[model samples]
Target: MPKMLCRCGKVVGLGEIPSSNQWMIISDTMITDEDWDDNGLNMSDFYKKMDIVVKCPECKRLYIYSKGFGNEPEVYNLEE
Candidate 1:
């Protein structure tokens, strides 16, 4: 597991390279190369499919999962 420290001095858990590649945390904003202009400057595509994903330092507060799109990890079951 890779350990990344947050600004608050907490060790963030990036346990496994996510079980599924289709899912990623939308941590920031980004535009892919294909969307760049002639000068290589990225053309705006905020509402498009391009995005920047990263591990949130605070998982408890910023975690999100898709119930139908990706396979959920098999950890301890959580009951409501």
Candidate 2:
């Protein structure tokens, strides 16, 4: 599998972002798993929202993940 990355074309996976709610996604709601992709997908459907996306550089990994916001968690954990 590919790794996480930065918009600057840099890989950031295998390590943490050092904090939550500080990272970006590369693509919208089309991740590695059907379920994980669906979490953001369902939310988008119900709330008419789009999942934030990010692309991994070296691995070309695309992410449709987000951090939570107050009252509502912006991101949800995926099931592997």
Candidate 3:
């Protein structure tokens, strides 16, 4: 498992089953009729097209994995 360190000194990590802080982002343009069918969703293909996002519970910082988890995430902080 990979862990990310937030600027607020909070550590975030993913699990086998995503917790409350883990999410996947898929672009609206990336979705098509072909991606869905009677056989249900193509999980493997969907996973490949999606980007990972993790939120730090303590500081509420967002770590975006647009370039994959192997690289550093693009951090986003709450403005308010």
Q: Which prediction has the highest lDDT against the true structure?
A: 3
Q: How far is candidate 2 from the true structure (C-alpha RMSD, Å)?
A: 13.0
The TM-score that candidate 3 achieves is 0.80
Select the stronger candidate by lDDT from 2 and 3: 3
User: What does candidate 1's lDDT look like per residue over 6-78, in tens digits?
Assistant: 4445566555665222234332444445445547543343323433232343442222333321533322222
Pick by TM-score: which candidate is best?
3
Number of clashing residue pairs in every model? Answer: 0, 10, 0
- After superposing candidate 3 on the true structure, give the runs of residues whose Cα lies further than 4 Å from its correct spot: none
Best-to-worst ranking by TM-score: 3, 1, 2
Clashing pairs in 2: 25-53, 25-54, 26-53, 26-54, 26-55, 27-53, 27-54, 68-73, 68-74, 69-74
Better of 1 and 2 by TM-score: 1
* Residues 1-80 of candidate 3: C-alpha lDDT, one tens digit per residue: 45666788877666547577788999999888777653688688788999888889988888888998788888898898
- Tell me the alpha-carbon RMSD of every candidate: 12.1, 13.0, 1.9
RMSD of 3: 1.9
Residue lDDT tens for model 2, 1-80: 13443554575543444423234443455444774656555644533333344444444444554442213223233344
After superposition, candidate 1 runs with Cα above 4 Å error: 19-52, 57-80
lDDT value for candidate 3? 0.81
